[model samples]
Target chain A: MMVACAVLPAAARSAAGPTNPFLRLPMVTIATHRLVLRPFRRSDAKEFTRLAGDWSVASMTSDIPHPLSEGQARGWLKPGRREVRFAIELEGRLIGGAGYYQRRSGTAELGFWLGREWWGRGYATEATRAVVHYGIEVKRLPGFTSSHFVDNNASAGVLRKLGFEPTGRGRIICTARGYEVEAVTYWLPARYAVQAQPVMARAASAGRWRAWLSRLAGRPA
Target chain B: MIDAIRTDRLVLRPVHPDDAEAIRAQIADWDVMRWLSQPPWPYTLQDAVDFIGSCSPDDLTTTAFAITHAGAVIGVIDMRINPALLPLRGPGPHLGFWLGRAHWGNGYTTEAARGLLASAFAAGVGDTVYSGAFADNAASLRVQEKLGFVRNTETLVFARPRGREFPHVNTKLVKSAFRTA
Candidate 1:
């Protein structure tokens, strides 16, 4: 596992070079207190398809139609896109996904989901905090917008715990639901983005040191 | 082979096609690329191949070398014309370099950059060498200052690895002010 990629925003997408635009960045790994947020690997397609494919996982978000196929999962995991995605891994098992989507020149929207089995463990909060921290500290994204389907109180609580203030309510297309669903929207300004206790600093040192040691010992990195 | 420059602690030599994997492993890092002004994110093997293919020992405009220690490619250093900055900054080759994340904090960047700068200047690469780091990249700025690169201005520059245009501290070193040691 080469394990290198970036949380690239829009402008940097094409600056990769003249030789090829088939841009695949090394995965940029994000570690939390108990979880690891990493780039989605090609090998993750099967697990991701099976997990994100569940109606329990897909119906809440604006995208990700239910019954997601392996091919669709593979396509979603492909690099070279404008947004940055991270596979939320807990104890080396893929639990769900989180990332910055709709990345514009300055800000991006936040999104995530977990398999039903993985929900309510505060895993979503921990993973999302790390992602938000990366956005604020690393990407310098000033603001982010997110929403939860009206009935999904779990997501609503997750957003509220993260300091997102409800901006409005509207019927948004839920590709998974196959219709317009009433969604309550919220926004997180930079000020509110600061409280996320990101474990990135410590994780970088521990992870980098471990990775360096492993490489020195000729282990797979 | 012919243009490899030897320093007290390192070897600065032409980037080779065979160095693709090492180059990829090191430069693909966010820790490395976050400060760079150009180049793609996620630096793939093909980009490494293309970069090595574009390098020329004799061409100052595209002078690039692999920094080696113990005969292992540990990093890369290059000086190339920045077409984007050429109009605004004027007549200078932009210098850029990076070491493997594991190799950092060892003063290898200072050592390797010193070696490359000495060679580039001796070959009459240019009268002026332009360099800078992201506003937040203090370590890199420190290296240039140690090399006698005087600070010039600050500008917002777009760097892909950072995923947005960021504040860049621009510096320039003239042939007269160049510190080779």
Candidate 2:
């Protein structure tokens, strides 16, 4: 229910002690060669309206409504408790959005949605990696957690690529489509916060070269 | 009520005022704090004082300890009631911990965690305990899974600071399963 942005500034902390007990970190921009994970711009509203308006993108996400309007996109761009929601952009056009939300206690959760056009591309992984890194290294958050509709294999794949493991599953009534769908839960620890050299090493050595080559070839080569 | 938990290479004891400096040092490291529920950046002596002062065993509902290795406090662990909700009559406590960056990757947390689970069971607190890791946090989840905590559910956490909802994976450990694993 709490919507958080990815680029919240640290200045938002109340000077009145730790009464709130919520820790918010600044937004981080993760850039790959072609994509720029940065704050959403007002100009992006039109593009976001078009992309998120698609039923394909809207169906998988929790809050997004199909036929997303310009006003809706503008509202979505507003900052939340954590940071500004980042417009996942490729070549300066908005493609998706991702950010962290501090829910309760010291825990925070990761969320993002990409347009259907960007599916199969690695932008989600790239942006997610950036946010995860910022959440751990910059915000100094404890961990990042997430879940997706069981049928959303693309989202699940993105989670796996970012090192999130399946933790559990449940059923949720989808408001958008008015149906109950199975939700798959996944989680990831701060790689730097905890010692996970072996896991990291395994992931790194697990045909990373091939993966990287495949990604390169898929690019505008 | 006072006891020392010993693992293969570490000791966890009741946190005392003397451990404030070490606690501050551990929290000051961004790496240690980043994965913690509390922001460890800008940790100061006052935070340590307040944290240690807040560790009241008399409450029984919430207990914390300083992790010691070779006579120095290097980390911390605590089991507390789920702050978001009242403790279910038979549900076990929620566990959380943070070790200094330098001491990580050496199996210290796992060792200490095992000891804590044992202590909790010995105290007859609850039939099962629950814990969680953020979706992007792989290490904490790995530790929980390694210690035999089963996945329970995924939650959309609303971080107030960022003002957004995030996905989280929750895990629980039942006593019977703990003993068996």
Candidate 3:
């Protein structure tokens, strides 16, 4: 995707002020080599339903309802007025989502979920790294709070890989079960978030470099 | 929209502009506002209006109410999901409330909070609700204790009004324990 940005008209590329190298870059849609994290769109409803509606997916989450009704996916895709949410896409296909929700008190929490087939590929971690980057590096949050069902070892692995530490235990509603479930809470400090997956950082920087070169060479891209 | 909840001694109703005056009067006093984490120290009528403006019960993230006794606003009670954390997917709204200084020590805070918890749990909002109180605020802590909130952790939380961090005890109430409590 970064290399693709090299083909844009040079005149348009240079329109961005060059006084600051970073300022010259375009708004990030959160891309890693294997995934693109962007804002959720209404058109993604069908795909979201197909993936997120699965019983396997819904049961693990504390909030997502099993048997997601028709059109409900679109409703979930609606932008939160004050929250940051994103759709995780692979080769332009929607696969999952990740983002933070800021409370009225000005604190925020990190949450994410992915389609079942996409599991075990490290997509959760890579996508999380991108969003966490946006949270700390872009949104400038100090850190985020997260949790997982004590029995959901897969989710625990994802949180652990992202550098989150167990803070304590608590009971939370599991919407899928319509009952409370035991869960372990975790808090990831800003310093750990700053160290999110290096591969994502390298991929993003490489894209910026290509864009920068295109602008410098006065090429159409 | 917020449905009015009637406790034995208080009415918990959705706040509106007309109630702003009473809200300001109650919260403007430092004695009542000292333990609050947000809303500036010197609160004003406009702050009350803005708060009511954002108090829609239909919002999935928050539910705000005016705690009334004998048809007069005495304080506010609310629950909100911490916006920063993304849940695996469930309602985990945190509990918060405050009463006019004069209304304290009468168990009104405890009564109002218990009623709110009952409503939230019945509606399938979550299996548990979380709350916290400044370590020094024995009154607030007592209310939690009376409602059967178990201490989960002790952490330093920022007090926006005072511009400093203070010791606080985080608490959680499990739904199953509601019957026993």
The candidates' DockQ values read 0.01, 0.01, 0.01
Arrange candidates by lDDT, descending: 1, 3, 2
User: After superposition, which runs of candidate 3 have C-alpha atoms over 4 Å from their true positions?
Assistant: A1-221, B59-61, B85-91, B179-181
Task: In model 3, state the lDDT of residue B152.
Answer: 63
* Model 1 lDDT at residue B154: 51
Q: State in Å the error of residue A8, model 2.
A: 32
DockQ of model 1, rounded to 2 decimals: 0.01
Which lDDT tens digits does candidate 2 get at residues B1-181?
5677788788888888888888887778756655554442367898898888878755334658889999999899887775332211115578788888888788777778888988888888778888876566778888888788876754333222222233455678888777423
lDDT score at residue B45, model 3, on the 0-100 scale: 94
Question: Which 10 residues in a row give candidate 3 chain B its minimum summed lDDT?
Answer: B82-91
Give the winner by TM-score.
1
Share of native interface contacts present in candidate 3: 0.00
Q: How well does model 3 score by local distance difference test? A: 0.69
The residue-level lDDT of candidate 1 at B147 comes to 90
Model 1, range A1-221, lDDT digits (tens) per residue?
00001123355442111211111223255545466666788899999888878887777766676789888889877654557788877767888888766454455677888888898889887777667766654554556777777878888778788888899987877777788888787888755665433332343234433443465599965
- How many residue pairs clash in each candidate at the backbone level? 8, 46, 17
- Across B29-123, the per-residue lDDT of candidate 1 in tens digits comes to 88788777667877899989988887776675676888999899999888888553543344788888888889989899998888878878887
Each candidate: what lDDT? 0.71, 0.65, 0.69
Clashes of 1: 8
